[model samples]
Target: MAPVSLGVLASGRGSNLQSIIDACRRGDIKAEVKVVISDRQDAYALKRAEKHGIDAYYINIKDYQDKAAYETKIVELLRRYNVQLVCLAGYMRLVGPTVLNAFPWRIMNIHPSLLPSFPGLHAQKQALDCGVKVSGCTVHFVDEGMDSGPIILQACVPVYDDDTEDSLAERILEQEHKIYPRAVGLFAEGKLIVRGKKVFIREAGND
Candidate 1:
């Protein structure tokens, strides 16, 4: 079967993007990153895409007049690349319904903390502030809400007493790098099923 073609949105270093790219290269995932887009001009994901010979572009939200206009413009870019899957890799922008309505369940995102616990920014700090012993990362299907979507997979990492927010985030980020690619591979292989608010992962023997 042909690999699922991806269009990833990013805003920063794109460590997750590199993971996806590596997964595809190693044949650990049956997917192709077709294009990468970022709102930030200096985003390293663009350079990484260029190094990988993938199409890359930038569309500034500031240049756009409104959020709706910005989202519409992004949707057009995704369409231009024939993107079948949309991955949000550290994209800071809150997407309007224009793109969400366009992709529906086809979009996936990796959130910093276990969702339904900390849904907004500074999630690692939220976990530390709330004094939770357990904190982790989540890969979920993107909905219109802030991190309120059907979860695909979650890997738990314990929080320690001596850990600061930055340290805890670093631990969670390691787990994020592990699972995000797996989640995308599962989706590409037709092994992940979403029913209502629940997610089903097929036993793929450590895939």
Candidate 2:
């Protein structure tokens, strides 16, 4: 099968984006990053995409009159690049309905803490504040709600009693890098099945 084409959106330093790129290059994922779009002009994610000779674009939200217009432009670019999958890697803004309707369950995101627990930013800090014994990373299908999507995969890490926010975040980030690529690989391989709020993983050659 041909490699799946991916469109990535990021707003900050894109460690997860880098992980995907490396995974594709290493043949660990049957996908290729066709284009990268960033809301911030100075996003390092753009630099990372350009470094790998991938098409990178900066779409300023201010340039568009409204959120819908902004996402329409994004959808245009994604379609132009024939992007089959959309990945949000450190993208700060909430995804509007325009984009959601355009891709449906084809969108994916990686969250720092186990989702439905600490979402909408500062997840590591939230875990520490809540005194959770285990914090983890989750890769899930994107939905209208904040990190409320159906989970595809997760990796857990023990929270140390003396762990600071950054310490916990670092451990979660390591897991994020691993599982995010694995989740994308599953999508590229047509091994993900979404039903209601649950995502089922199909075994190889089962279909």
Candidate 3:
């Protein structure tokens, strides 16, 4: 079978993007990153993609008139790559209707906290402030709302009493690296079925 083609959007160092790239290369995930797009020209994610010989693009958000226009251009880029899936790795922008409507449940994102919890930025600090004993990462299908999508896979990390924001985040990031690829792998294998707010991962070859 042909590998699932992925269009990855990122805005920072792209550690999760690196994890996905590594996963694909190791055959741990039945997918290939077709292209990478970043809103910032200096984002390291673009460099990561280029290093791997994948086409990388930098779209200037300031040039677009509105969020819709910005997302429309992104959608155009993704379509050009014939991307089968969209992954957001540390992509700071909230997804707009244009991209959401284009991909539907085909989009995935890795959030730093066990979502429905610390959702937006500084999630680790949010978790630490709330005194939660456990903090983790969630891989979920992207929707119109912010990190409100149905969950696919999650890995928990114990929050130690002495854990600072950086410490908790570091542990959670490790889990994120593990699960994002697994969730994408499930999608590649046709095992992910979304019904309302729930995502069901079916047995391999049984679906």
lDDT of 3 by residue, 7-124 (tens): 9999999999999999999999999999999998999999999999999999998998988989999999999999999999999999988999999999999999888899889999
lDDT of each: 0.92, 0.96, 0.95
Candidate 1 residue 84 Cα shift, in angstroms, is: 1.0
Question: Which stretches in model 2 have alpha-carbon errors above 4 Å?
Answer: none
Question: Candidate 3: misplaced stretches above 4 Å?
Answer: none
Task: Kindly provide the TM-score of model 2 when superposed on the true structure, using C-alpha atoms.
Answer: 0.98
Candidate 1 ranges beyond 4 A from true positions = 202-207
In order of appearance, the predictions have TM-scores of 0.95, 0.98, 0.98
Q: What is the overall TM-score of model 1 with all chains considered together?
A: 0.95
Model 3, position 164, has a per-residue lDDT of 94
Clashes of each: 0, 0, 0
Q: Which candidate model has the greater lDDT, 2 or 3?
A: 2
**What value does the lDDT take at residue 111 in candidate 3?**
95
